[model samples]
Target chain A: MKRLKYILMTLCFSAAGLLQAQESMKSLMDERRENREANYAKWGPTSEHDGMGFIVRAGYVIGGTSPLPLPAEIRKINEFSPKGGFSLGIDGYKYFNMRWGLSAGLRFFMQGMHTGANVKNYGMSIVMGEDIVSGNFTGTDITETRMSGFTIPVMATYRVGARWTFNLGPYFSYWIYRDFDGHVFDGYLREGSPVGQKITISADNPAFYDFSDDMRSCSWGMEFCADFRVREHLNVFGLLDWGLSDVFKDDFQTVTFPMYPIYATLGVAYYY
Target chain B: MRKIFFGLSLAAILGLVSCIQDEPLNAECDIEQAVVVTDDAEAWLLNASEAVQDVPSADTTIVFYLREEFMDENYEGWDRLKDVAINFRLTPGATITPENGSAHDFTQGGVYYHVTSEDGAWQRNYHVMFIPVQPLTVTYDFENFRWESLERYCEWFEYSDQGNEINMWATANPGFAISKSSATPEEFPTIPWENESISGHSVKLETRDTGLFGVMMNMRIAAGNLFIGTFDVANALQDAMAATRFGLPFNKKPLRFEGYYKFKPGEKFQNRTGVIQEGWVDDPDLYAVLYENTDENGQSFTLQGDNVLTHPNIVALARVTDRVHDFDNWTHFDIPFEYYKEIDEERLKTYGYNLSVVFTSSIEGGAFCGAVGSTLLVDEVKVTCEDEDE
Candidate 1:
């Protein structure tokens, strides 16, 4: 037992030394990649072309959102967004030994958000003194809305090391579908009262009416994704997509104001 | 290769250590902060008297201006009016009552011309029947009665001590009386017999000696009489003067009455249609006879006090009777301005800017005789302008 223990201790020490040696190798590789990246940055695209190799990239697409304040009396009903969607893209390694590659692919990302708000139709009667007008009247309809849009990232990639890769470029997408269901002064005023007048409001026109219009259209922006390989041909990465163009053409006319769908995802990628 | 591998391993360890030091030192940026402070204190008064200015009095009369320029194109009948009296035991309440009078206009709404009350709690009310001399302006002399005194007469003495009662209630006084008469004294609700005559005439007070005389008269009307007139200035003035009673000029004239003579000098003494008798006679403890002038141009005009023999104007006082004017179809011919030349222009102007000279039946002596009632129609009766005099 004592001899076995000694053998085990020796094995452990050897393993520790091996790990230290491997760490040193990783640092050397990282330093080499950094030097190459600096050189590339100074001269733009580098000329280090190698044999053709395929890069399978997978990563988290992250997006930041700023909550917009609604109009004076407009109410937000509900928002539909994608909790998370998996993205997969393929890149063709061309030129010198997989050093530079051009990538092209389509990604179907869906974001469904659930949010809602309410608005108050303002009015007054002689019964209530003129001075004491209601700020938030009870007899007003609360507008409910649900928005959804799609994103597809397309770009080119340049690799500095076996694991480190940087991607830069633009993306295109279409808000294939959206639904908004509305009710006029729902549950607000009684049938016969003036306050009970049914009114349906929309984002398409300045006039409030008793109808609805479709809003799904094509909108696009830019994107940047970086991958850090955990091992050969495998990487965990981060991606950011910013909307270059507005989702709503007429943000002011749209009764619900402008809301651009943004997102962030965490995932893995495989490179060949 | 061995040396190279060893060098790489050492560099990797150092790099990891440097990477660990790159974390942010500050982490409190995400916490929320709040602050609160008090607002400034200030006072404000809205729509109060300080915010409004009184309408300045002008020598030029708006009533006369409107009368001439603005005529009611819808006038359908004769210019007729009745002064419906709204009496108050505490304060003499007067305003055009609803009587034959249209709801649209009343002296343009006629008001109770004069209010009389005796020492006793007994009060009497009377309404004047006449035509406007030109939608003559009707304004109450608010200063005439004490504010505290008039307040008691408002409705039933409620709201008597109001702070802004003077100006607030001035708009609804003798010229315009507001009623809160849900409760009223039983006996005082009706017009007194002395003031029952519809004509606008003289009030007779009798006296042996100046002492408390237990006499009273009062008038009350629910609604009905109204005044009608063209918007024409002349017509409005004529309609407004319909309910007015003119006091005789204080002149010493020795007169004799032999047989039945016309009370009026010429033409009809009282309007055949709109005639009213007003005034009364008091006789000490004996019989208090109340006479009204019903006959046009043919009634008596004299009032004798209980002390007629001892009175200064003994003869005139002895032969007093009720008189009414035959005012129908009469022009300004027989009764000229000279008829009442003894009346002081200044005194008449005080009641209003307009003054009308009318024939008066009287004895040579001045005496408090019986009352008289009569109706007279006056038109375009206003202050004589220098241009008109010329």
Candidate 2:
């Protein structure tokens, strides 16, 4: 848990450095670009609306999960280690003008989170198949999950001050695989309600569960991306795919949190 | 491109609110442990570990074995126990009757324990029975054996004290064996079959290590043992009343306790907390105690580890301290009853006196300290009633 905290902290501080570098790099290229401005009358297909092309990109994704309804104090989230996933996509775009455009694309990505927590005093009612995990907890708990799928996203794109670019879109996904599993250790479980007798969860008295097939197979969500061109045909990008649907099937409620996958990624792309 | 990506991200956020699923439930079904802490040494021992407690329930049954001679009608407890100060160690998400350890009036029926599964779909209803104290029988040959499907072994049950009829004996083997053992009589540790017995199979007790997990819970050692009353595991960690207890209601002043036994002591000498003694030797224990079954206020009391050997209420005692410690052959040994207080003849009819013939592989096993390889085998045990014809 402490390691995860430190990693996230590092990410927060490094973000600003990357942004500053990108801006400085953009400015350094601006003066040179002005000296070599393309002819407006005959810029060929490289200028604005005159262009129609495809771009392929691959990226590294970081996902975030929030276990809601369970107040922070109750679910004293102790450890969080988000496995970095990957995304690859191809998109075709047409510019209406130099600054505005529309794009549609197919993207494949894997997103999820691994976390350790403790349910101290807050009570939650969870259902895992024919079982119920309902009650407050003070024991160590861990949950690891993942969803791999493809998304069809329709994005609006904009070019800002030369080659700096941004895109945002809504997408629909059809997932091929998912896994949800966890363990509760050295704790007592009140089988039924708050007033239930306790079952010990320790080395001698242990418990583990799986909720893989019970997850949702299809969902809808949104994606956003920002890119800076390093060359005429190559661009480095950062993207965030925010899931709007719960990973679990409609009837499944084993996890008390309304968990949505917020995947963030950075990659390089080739425009052709 | 930036404008297009930003616009799509806003649109995805719109559906985020509607995608929330239902919540999960807590799945646990167990009665962790229970204890009694009333500060009445003459009546109730404060330590649950000294008594028979923490009895693991069958998936469907919650068993709370009581060890006293008579229950206080208002058994929420006396003095300390009534203040609702005692707590139950349950699963993280579990709740119990007498909500929050409040004073519960168990004078009528049972305490109910409901366990909800993790997925909110299923739950179990456990009927927790705190069997009140009653008189037990004498003269045990250790013959009755029945196979209960749950344990997949020959198991014996505690006889009811209410009806004054009993054909069974009790033991600390339940706590000693440690695991969810499903072995028959000829198995390891507790139920080892006795081949050299003069009669049917005798009881063979061997000391054991309950394992690392048991040690983590402070239950490191399990001494081979058999006794006359309850050994409730739920209250095993509290006071002697909750864990180690050894007397049942009896009327007459017994003359002697005679039994055939074989012995072998394990090499190591240690205490319940796992502290090893450098030069101490382990020895098996056997004794018969006749003590007052009622306190000064006429309240019921059962002899427990705290006061069994030294209590002022004791009327007679028969103990074996100089037995042949390493004998393998079945040997006959007898201890004559020594009287402390005069037997009150009228009190005998009122069931105010009790007798306990207890045996264990290690004398200090109750404190979680004992030798690991020690074994005690016994058969043909008989308690001489005070009848003149005998």
Candidate 3:
């Protein structure tokens, strides 16, 4: 009975100490929350309240408008280079809570690439005045593609910590300018089909082709973005835009495969 | 923090770069080369080089010229072509019908071969023939023409006394079709004109603009031309001067060349770059050349546009020096062959010489320098030969 009494007294003392520790922990958490709220109130645009805010972002874009798995007609890639384009956007966000938000943004971006590839029996068409010369070409092709457009993105956002936010959603783009042009050198073309008459194109006298009009005017795709807060109102962000639609229109058959526009951007975002 | 941001950016970029994978199976079907493997190639072929031929990407016909003696119907060697084996080099992963290296009777006509791509999505047909070397006709009326290349252009051919079609004439019509595929038969650089003629339809040659394609290639104009040899379309864009292989094998001596023609100069003459040349006028060209077909080393030789008149092996030349400006009336021209080198009588009987008769709308057309609307009409051409005594 004496030993049981001693054990009960020790357990009571331990429970009191644990209660005091819990009280201190709760107070500490409350103080941090108050400080965060004070900071949010001071910076109105960066607040986590249920209100609207805007952000402006600028970044460099680098990627290609290319066919998936590259068709067999392309025998080799001789050279490839990104044309060094940029993206600029303004986004409006509505925070539902500290962990959830929605954002809609309008962006203007440019994407371009230059490539040299060796192709065999590749289908193509070239404009000669009023005529469209369709043929299968077997030779070296040097191509350049450039596109500039305005995009509207609607995304759902999730905030993990005070400094991290993730965004994913669909984006619609309206292209104002598009260009897909190239030259075929040191090769031969079979007019009309693979079995058609052969016309040789020399390096000095390369055949030129432009398919700018065949590109689609509007495109929709998905974008994934992650933003890391670097300052009170500044963030470093990375975004990946994956195109679900083809770069060319449906009726365009000169390009044997469907080409998609895929790009990634890394830049800074300023909250206002 | 900066390191983390860079890490994420680098990873995203790397992912994008890795999207391109290995290429798939070949989608083209073609015969790159063709050859006849024989035990005695020298006895069967006219020349050793004739045993193998590198096929152009655009060509579907493979022709092998045989020795004249072997081509005789009564000769036993004529039957040997039935058992000869032929081999072909095809595009990778391509299969051919009747199998490669299979023997076929080429003495009857051209043997057809169909090639299918590895992916089985594309196919091409080829015609292979072994025939005797053909001879040029002595007279031309410019009355025979047919629509060729899916009816895209007009091609002229002759008929022998035996009523067999003789393909002894060539033109730049096929080359023009590359740039102007939608052009009508009458809009072509060379066409059969039914308006005026000595007896039948006359040949009309015109200088035409090659459109944007021509400007891009620095060959702005395509001048109409007719010749007694082959126009190698394979080299038409690369080396145009070498594309025109002039002359055909001839055993007789030509004394004179006679023809009727009407010519009109275009309003503005231009250089190769399509820039107008001040005070310059375009003129038509009519010429005949006879040259040794074999060099001193016994190798076969033929004249091209660059050296048809300047080669040291030339035996004779009959070129019109007078410029004809009349467009309304036909002018008759008869010129005697002027000799530059002595003829080898024994070699002449063995087909050692080659003769070519050429007509062009513009004299400098070979260099892509001409006027756009220059036209030349020609008809009733004849080549008179010397008697055996002379």
Candidate 4:
């Protein structure tokens, strides 16, 4: 009988300890909620509580629309320069809770690049009036690429504490203008194939090639972004857009390689 | 925050630099130089310099001329050539059939060497020959012509009395193909005129517009021309003056240049930039030149379009002075070769002189200044030579 009584007392003590632990855990949760509320309130009237808000963003872009794992035909990049480009956009953010949210935005962006590269056996087709001349070139290629477009991004956002947020999703772009032109110099071109008639191209009389018409009209990509709150209504942001579609049309065979438009942007945003 | 930015920048740069990995193998298969290995090269070759030939990028034939004594059927040099070895300097990593520096029987016409590129993606066939220097025929009938390998256009050639085809004529046809690839063989700047000839087929050279591509390249016109020498198409654009390498080694003294021609000029004479020059009348040109084949240093040399008529090495010249403009009927021209230097009899026997005959529809065609549609028809061209025994 005494052993049964002792077992009952031990069970009661265990139940009481469990209740106390549950009470402490509940208080801890309450404290964290309060802290989160206080942190959100510090962002002034721009910060929304389980609702929707708007943001205006402006950014600078400095990256190239290039091929992934560059092809072997491109032997070396002698020089590279990112021409000045910018992005301006407005985004709508809807919050479900303290941590999870959704964002959709439209942006106008422009990107330009100038590069000099050394290549060997690089196949290309140049526009000559109404016709095209196809050849394999081995020499220095100077290229200039420019693209301007309107982009729409839909993303899932996660808020980290009160000052930082991250988002990632798909983006759709429709190009308004595009240009891809270049010159090949200080080399010899085999007209048609590698074993065809050789034509020497000097620096002063380099061959010009333009593939602007071959560029695609629309491209889709993935965008990853981070925003850091600098003030109550202002935030600094960084974004990376990696194109999943090729820059050229499906039937274009001149470049022989698929190129992507991968760009990174750094900017500031104002929330309201 | 600053550290994060720095790290991201560094990562981007590293990613870019790391994309450049190992380079691809060379895709060019070419024989830059060829040399015949012999105990006494001077005894077997026409000139000691003839043993080694620097092959141009645009040429596929590597020819080494043999001494005149080797032409004798019983000469011992024939046996030596049958077992001769030729060494070739090829593009890096390229491989060749028949083995480099291996002996070959060049006496059986010639040997063909096939070179495969380092990447194994391309191959080029080269014809290497060791033959006695043969002179071209005294008369050109313009009746022998055939389509080139690509069948894009027709090219003119001559045949020896031994029934061997000789590539002694060159034109700007190859260069013209670049601009007007859709043109027919008959539409080319140089074509054989069948109905408009004195007797057999005659050569018709006409200046034609190069079209859109020519405009983009700032080369508005291509004047038809026929010359006795090799046309280096590789330099046709940037250095046109150097493209026309004139002359073939001659073993006899030239006496005169004789030919019959019909000429007609286009309506408007235009400059290279397509600017019409008022009151400018287009004129045809016909000339023959003889010059020393070797410089003072004993290196073989040939005249180019820039210096064919004005070079100090010229020994003789025969040019038509009284041109009959707009002659619809065939006009005869017989101009005597004016000798400026005494002929060295011993050098003449050894093929130490070079001869060239050039005819063009436009006099200033090399400068890209000419009238489109200017036409010149030539027939029965002849080069009279002195007797070898004299």
Using DockQ as the measure, which candidate wins?
4
Q: Report per-candidate DockQ.
A: 0.01, 0.04, 0.46, 0.47
In candidate 2, how many Å is residue B171 off? 2.1
Better-scoring candidate (TM-score), 1 or 3: 3
Docking model 2 quality class? incorrect
How big is the RMSD of model 3?
3.6
Expressed as tens digits, the lDDT of each residue in A21-118 for candidate 2 is: 99999997985565334532122124544667788988766655554334543445566666757888898987776567788998888877787766
In the range B57-84, model 4's lDDT, one tens digit per residue, is 7678888888878767788768877788
Task: Compare candidates 2 and 4 on lDDT and give the better one.
Answer: 4
Q: How should the candidates be ordered by lDDT, best one leading?
A: 4, 3, 2, 1
Model 1 interface root-mean-square deviation? 33.2
Looking at model 1, residue A70 earns an lDDT score of 32
lDDT per residue (tens digit) for residues B1-390 in model 2: 434544544344323323444433444544556554444433444112223345354334443335454355565443333232334555556555445455654434555656554445545566544444444555666765555343533454434435433523556654433332332444445563557676887878778766543444466677777777656543443332346666766766688888888888888887767878888888888888888876887666777766678888889988887867756577788878888888899778555676777888877777667888888888777778687354
Please write out the lDDT profile of model 4 over residues A78-160, one tens digit for every residue: 98887638999999988787678889999999987888999888887665655456788888999899999999999998887
TM-score for chain A, candidates 1 onward in order: 0.49, 0.76, 0.82, 0.87
Model 1 fnat? 0.00
Query: Candidate 2, chain A: TM-score?
Result: 0.76
